[model samples]
Target chain A: MKILDIYARLKRDMNYIEKELEKSIYSDYTIMRETSAHLLKAGGKRIRPVFVLLAGQFGNYQLDQIKHVAVPMELIHMASLVHDDVIDDADTRRGQLTVKSKWDNRIAMYTGDYIFAKALGVVTQLPNPWIHQIMSKAIMEMSIGEMEQIRFFFHTGQTIRNYLLRIKRKTALLIAISCQLGAIAANAPKSVSQKLFLFGYNVGMAFQIRDDVLDLCGTEQQIGKPPGSDIKQGNITLPMLLALQEESLREPLLQEIARIQAVDGQTDVSAFIRMIRGSNGIVKAEAMAARYIEKAIVALKDLPDLQAKKDLIRIAHFVGNRSY
Target chain B: MKILDIYARLKRDMNYIEKELEKSIYSDYTIMRETSAHLLKAGGKRIRPVFVLLAGQFGNYQLDQIKHVAVPMELIHMASLVHDDVIDDADTRRGQLTVKSKWDNRIAMYTGDYIFAKALGVVTQLPNPWIHQIMSKAIMEMSIGEMEQIRFFFHTGQTIRNYLLRIKRKTALLIAISCQLGAIAANAPKSVSQKLFLFGYNVGMAFQIRDDVLDLCGTEQQIGKPPGSDIKQGNITLPMLLALQEESLREPLLQEIARIQAVDGQTDVSAFIRMIRGSNGIVKAEAMAARYIEKAIVALKDLPDLQAKKDLIRIAHFVGNRSY
Candidate 1:
């Protein structure tokens, strides 16, 4: 059960999905084609597609059966980034200029819409009601998560429970469904698909907690985002939520966040980074993420015997335990 | 067939569809629910939903059959408006404040995504692939049309053909699909569905051309938008395109447009309105709209012997011949 083997297979499917995406996005309007191409070029890890492929392997695996969900799920991820960029007032993504940065905000927004429509068009080509239901529900959850983020912004009394829920919906929910839909598309037994979905969901939870950690502790060069950028943007992730819970640290922490808000993009972010890290919040956050990873591993016990299953287990470990 | 009777029927259907929309859009994220509720409050003519219902009558005419199309078609229309308002920097719609204006552009964008997700979710309740295919394609076309509009803004040498193509995709294509999808959902004969689709398509074309006319000549009291606002936004619609064709008027008209570009929300608006109305462009544009209305009437020749069909025919004439 080699992780490399799973990576290779997922990459192959991603290439096919990528080509389909390229062809489907073609339009007589040159700007749509151009802008979509630019956003696509800001490549993602294709993690959702990988989950789709890996989940399919637990059942009657077929590359063709899985590509429908794999492609559209990935496209959904891509579509949301354009809108997210506008919301975040982000200048760069994945070390490249964002869609809104390169073009005006309006064109970037419509480009997101154009990609979303293409995704829906592409997925409905597959003859399955359940697949559409799963994918569309994932989109709904992701949108709600986004709205929640906007609502919670600048709220100093952010609870750890609410933070976890927000992260699950915003970042993990779609990834979870990517796996579940793949299994369903491949005609896996409902139980097998459901187990895989649970595994995916738990891992997604752990993955986002780590992302919050990386935003606070990892160097800007490693992650392509400024350290403490989340707090600056008024997003209180799990780490910040945990840090805010300590009464001794509360007032200074809130004051620092206030200063971050008052400062422009070039504010001294490193001081806040050190404060969060040194307060023992990161350690507690890591332990919480580990619990989710363990839960994900337990969910995998129900899967049918396959090397793909083992690879997924390893990927979960890799996501939660990755140091750099 | 009485137009009032047709309006009554449409109003009933719209009320039910609006309820469905409300139920589908609500989420635990209360902000998403409330923002979408605000957006739905900006009442529209429900023209798309009406087409969906009328077109379904061409098939196995049933209230239930038409609703599946009508609800989603209207939701899709509303979703587009949410995003469009953001793109257009529009402050109002239907004499009410726009979503982007009431909430920031960020909320408007997410609210659009939320509605789009809900629309796609609702459509899957019907077990028909063709409905999804047609509706998805319509959405894709709408996005591309928006791109074309953005790209062509303020370009002086733009032709009438380019303008027509843009509006055809932006405005006409969705209405055409609403008709086709409604019929398809009801299991209407393909030929009848095709005829209704063509009828709707041509009428939509005339509807937009007449809209362009009103944008150039109608008073603010008659139309919510100020006259010549399209040109103010740098979109060279049919009236301006026709005016641009004359050798005597090209440079002076372009100078007027250049002045439009230099100003943000104000210009010598009254003089420009007077100039367009006084020119032969107004008459030529009206003639072009009339052609499409006649074509729409011809497209309805094959509709069934029903009161709904007769009402649709009258609505086409009303849409085309309405001077205000």
Candidate 2:
């Protein structure tokens, strides 16, 4: 089934989460309200919230109980996006002006901080110290991951292991906790929550790998931003890393990267994009993504035969195959 | 009862907190560790930790228990300072280069975020959900106050009430919670915690008012940064706002402010500083600070006569009178 079908199934609960997200970001200040609402309007797939809701289904599912987890999951994701746009010096995200671009970097920074603090505010209402602990640790790891990305920019010497670890912290850990926290909030069995965490973690890894692959391969319409944004920002993604390892492509690829770096990525990167697209790197990265999807599916094997389980398996496949 | 005397009394417990503060910011990432360590080394008065420790004395005071609240209070303050330096475009803070100046803005931003997350991580170790709720809400208010400061920058049309509300969120709420959470963590009586919160809030208001006054009146050697930094950065502090209300200084001060704004505050602000100092603004602001201190002392009237109460009262007086 398509992602839309899954959303359709959880439509009512998703609406509640959407409303909570709006409520959570509301501010008395006009500029803050406007900036935060602008980000909410330029929305994403809300994948984290989806994972949260689905994982909640594994326990005593209650929309009231689950939303506290779901809303913060999305809010944390939104907060990171605001900060990420600032760090990347990105003008637009998802085809709209970023918080930094529309307002200023300082405003964007505070907006992100506001949203993040608001997220903690929502989660703390749950009275579960474990959720607070897990969420805070995840946030810390994500910040470290962000710093690592900056440190590794244009440094093509990084290994695949380095990339995996960074992405795990950056993307997978939050998703993993979304599932775990959702389960924990819903009073799921510990063993079930562990399985869900593993499932979500693998799915998140594949999702990011697919995203990196799409940055080079997808059109602006497909990805919601310019193609090769990763290369433009000197973010050496999985495909590019794999491409650099190819004997035939290594020297020219390095030179192309050097050329991009020389201009501070101001010049056209279509040539570099074309070169990578023609190489075996895309296939290798796709294979890696597929492997992650398989692992995700394997993780869900011991889970109860619920509709949520079936939906998760399909979502994993879709994540691996999705172009956007 | 000097601030140093209070520190001397709490010296041993304070040292444990200092060590914990160091331990909390530790990261496996080299740059993260270095940047965080740099901020820690450029220490402030550690006033928040002092408040936490002093407030704990009214309870079942334990170094180990109170350290959790104390460390996070200081970390949150440090995180806000790092971000504040970015907003202020400040090269130095407290006679040392700021995080943004030493590294880049992006790194500084991440370092602030990382430190803020670590603060939450430390705080959540306490299973008291109320502590989390209060801390999270205070952080939210702090961010809002920060945004309001940005919104009101160079805005000469603002009122005294506007300034007071902004400072309340920016300074007082965190300090209030620092005391409240400390009392809570140590299982202080609710009445005692409430009293401490009031004491902290009023003192914090006085503290910020005094700080703003010092920004204009004190020397670079005394304040550890250049005098008139507030006007240079378009932060219309109490003295400037009070001076703006003066009939004689109004138009000329507006002109000078316009001149500073035109140059984006790059020009020397000594003339503006001299104008404010020569006006009644400084004395009026000092009087307002003294009033807040009186209220702070009054807040402790019903509290049990303990050394902590006397210390709190002394700290409030010092905050009002402090030159730096």
Candidate 3:
């Protein structure tokens, strides 16, 4: 019955996961060791690991077994991000120059590979098919999602269902797997694991939606990124699509969209931002996020009485309501 | 004392491996499957799987188990080539238009991912620690080699040792792992497997050196690539480094190097090819390939009396002496 704030607990767990990840990549190549260290130091929210740890608590929860799953899941996340920055041709990540922008695209790609190798190597230590099954499957889905995103970029007619499925593959599904893996590793009952998985899935969907909303509403300092960035990158997020629907605003929107698209895919972005803000896009997005929160909570209602489950529910609520 | 010509046997085995690879990727993504199949079909000697199958025969061999290792290893090789084409921005491969060239970079990247997924999925079926360990580490090395290659592009003063090391990771190590994994999967004694590893390692090193020679000496029709293409790509291959040592040849070499660099960084390349062909670079490179063939034979002296081992040695000699 230890009632600890989720972020604080996440901070504690991430410290160890961070340490283990750093230790794992130590090799004779001093340069590779140093480069990998720089990437780890770049830092991330460690949301995936947090999902894993929390989900483990829903079962018999052995920390030793859970670490194996947690580390690899996070590394996979890290590996994907390095490649992502390259594909996005991004300059800065977390207020620092990305591995790609700093060294080059190739180093970024290898750094990703090094991390993936280290992660997969760790999975071998776990004597089970369950973990490999979940992890490899997750990687496959994430890759397919990325490919679809790349293929469908700037295609305005893509349905919300398609968008949802893509995001599910790209973002939410991994988070869901993290929880499922943690629960299974701890030998948690199948029903408990399924419920935890349901909870993770619903929260993940809402989490990505909130991220899109932040890209529209949150300031550069607020979200650690410039607002309307996705639109600028020609990735039509939910709010931008909603704004696109108002045909009455078509001329001005079209002008702005054309201007953005005209910059050879490097539009100023703020014009669309201003438009989205003025429109009720933000409000509509938040309402949608609220609906997801309700769904996530309902998934948890049948779970065993535990403070950890309550904390998870609280985090989901906060994710929906968090301001810039 | 089985006097079967190893090269002819290898050619037959390679063809079998290629057909199996095509069958493995036959899925619903017809475009992707065909794109991958075309790359596999547009031939290169399937040296890797040949090494794996040959190595497997050293122990308790099973076609079923060995095929899992051999087919996936070849698929991974094919996948890397597909991605390498995009990363290298090369237009043609194996005398055919590259996927990136015929389609686009995004499709090419996805095709690589799809093939990579299929590769891992196939390898995981073996359910052995040794296979995963070898395959995953080989993949990591391949990625690191790629990173190094990208980083060093157009930087001409790198030591011969560094170039060799880079090529080892990029080429030799994967082939070495192919042999080692083959031996391990067949339940060969550790000592036998280690010898097979060394045998493959030396041959792979010589194999790459021969390729560098061919890149300088062979014509497009004979080698499936234009002569001096490596120089055209700003790659300081062994032959280029050897050619640069003569101070008298240095300026013209430097000028050709500069022209190649220009073509690589962005310019027309036909003129650069013209510059390199008009030089003494090719002959010196062939002598170095000859030296490596001798070194590769030295690695096999301790192995047991087996027909597979003898044929492997003969193939290495053939590869070393072959000319376009």
Candidate 4:
């Protein structure tokens, strides 16, 4: 099935999740309500919630039970994004002004905290202690991954293994747990939830790798922000790291990165973007992402063959191949 | 019991709590480890944990069970302080360089997130979902209170009711839950825990009021920061608001505040500090705090007259009358 087809299939349930998201972040404080509502309206693909809903299909498929997992997953994702914007000094996200830009960094910080707390509040309404454990661990890992990103900024000496670990913590773990928790919430067998976790984890890896590659290659309209924002913000992603390994591109790219760092990322990065695009980095990164997608599909092989399984496989492929 | 005697009574368990706090914040990353450890070392009174441990005595009083509540209370407090430093642009807290100052705002933000996640992880080990629910709600209220603080900064029109509400969320809620959760963790009677919550809530109110008054009237050595730091940062405390009501001081105080705002708080605030100190604001704020302490004592009137009850009352008095 196509990505749009899956979203359409889940449209009614997704609407519930969306409204629940809005309700979860509602605050009596005017500025908080405005800032959080601002973030809620600046929509994304809602892929995490989608993954949760699909994974729940493998179980008894109860929307009420699964939304407890789904909404918090999306809320956590939203909270991290707000905090990330503050760290990235980003003004725009998903083609809208960020909380930090629209209000201020302090507002963004507390808004993120408030949303995260709301997410916890929603999830804790579930009676399972295991779900709480997994969610909190994912949050801790994500935070460590965020700090690692800051530490690795402008440092080209980082290995591909470091990049993988960072992205695994920063993105993949939450996705993995979304599937795992969704299945568990709906009373899926432990074996099925474990397999779904592996599937989500591999897909999340591909998803992030594709995102990094798109940062270098996608247009302004396609990516929703300026291309090369990663490099401009000194984030050395997998593609950039892979590109640095090219002997012919290494010296010139290093010099360009050095220049950007010297000016504290004030310079235009179109030249740097062009150089990476012209290199083998794009193809190599795509190949790695395809490998992760393959593993994701393989993880689902042991599960009962259902339409949701096929949809998961299709979503994995879409994540691997999507240009935007 | 004297405060030192209370510490002596709980020394062994408090040591375990201290170690658990260290273990809770442990990270594989060097920077995460160092920043968190630094915060742990630059300790405050650990008053929240003390309340938790003391409140646990009214129940079955298992140190193992109560430490979970105690440690997380302190960790959440630590996490908020780290984030507050980022928002306040504060360099020193408790006579040590703030994480934001020593590293950067990005590091401080993630460090706070990491610590908060760890707190949740520790708390979820307990089987009771109610604890998680209460904890998460307190976190949400605290974040709202933090945002309200920013919203009310330098706004002289804010009433005493607004200030009370802000501090209730920011300070009292967590302390109240610390007592409530501690009792619940130890399997205390519902009525007992409810009363403990009320006791903690009032003491926390008085505790914050005393801290605010000391911020203006105390020396740098006494408060661990500068005397006029609150006014300098545009934090309009109760004493300041009360002082603003004075006919003799209103015009000059407003002018000084305006001048500080004009320069973005870069100028000397000693003149502002002296004016508020010499006014009747301190005496009136003290009276209000004393009322809270009285309420706190009244909360414990029906609890069995154990030594723990006396300790709780003495702690309430200490909070109300603390000079530093």
DockQ winner: 4
CA lDDT, candidate 4, residue A180: 95
Ranking by TM-score: 4, 2, 1, 3
Q: What would the per-residue lDDT of candidate 1 be over residues B9-100, giving only the tens digit for each residue?
A: 77777687678767777777767767777866767778888888877777686776567778889888899988988888889766788878
Residue lDDT tens for model 3, B1-324: 222366566666666666788887775544666676678667776777878888888888787788888998888888788878877778888779999898777677657766666676677777887778878788878877887776666677887888889888999888888888888889898888887777777777777878887776667787776666665555777777766776777777677667657656455555544444554655666676677777767766777778778777877777777663
TM-score of each: 0.96, 0.98, 0.90, 0.99
Note the Cα lDDT for every prediction shown: 0.82, 0.91, 0.75, 0.91
After superposing all C-alphas onto the true structure, candidate 2 shows an RMSD in angstroms of: 1.3
Put the candidates in DockQ order, highest first.
4, 2, 1, 3
As for DockQ, the candidate ahead, 1 or 3, is 1
Q: Write the per-residue lDDT of candidate 2 for residues B96-141, one digit (tens) a residue.
A: 9998999888889888898888888888778787888899889888
Looking at model 2, give its docking quality level. medium
Name the regions of candidate 4 deviating beyond 4 angstroms.
none
Look at candidate 1 and give me any clashing residue pairs. Answer: B59-B188
lDDT of 4 at B59: 94
lDDT score, candidate 2, position A74: 94
Question: Which candidate would rank higher by DockQ, 1 or 2?
Answer: 2
Enumerate clash totals for all models, in the order shown: 1, 0, 0, 0
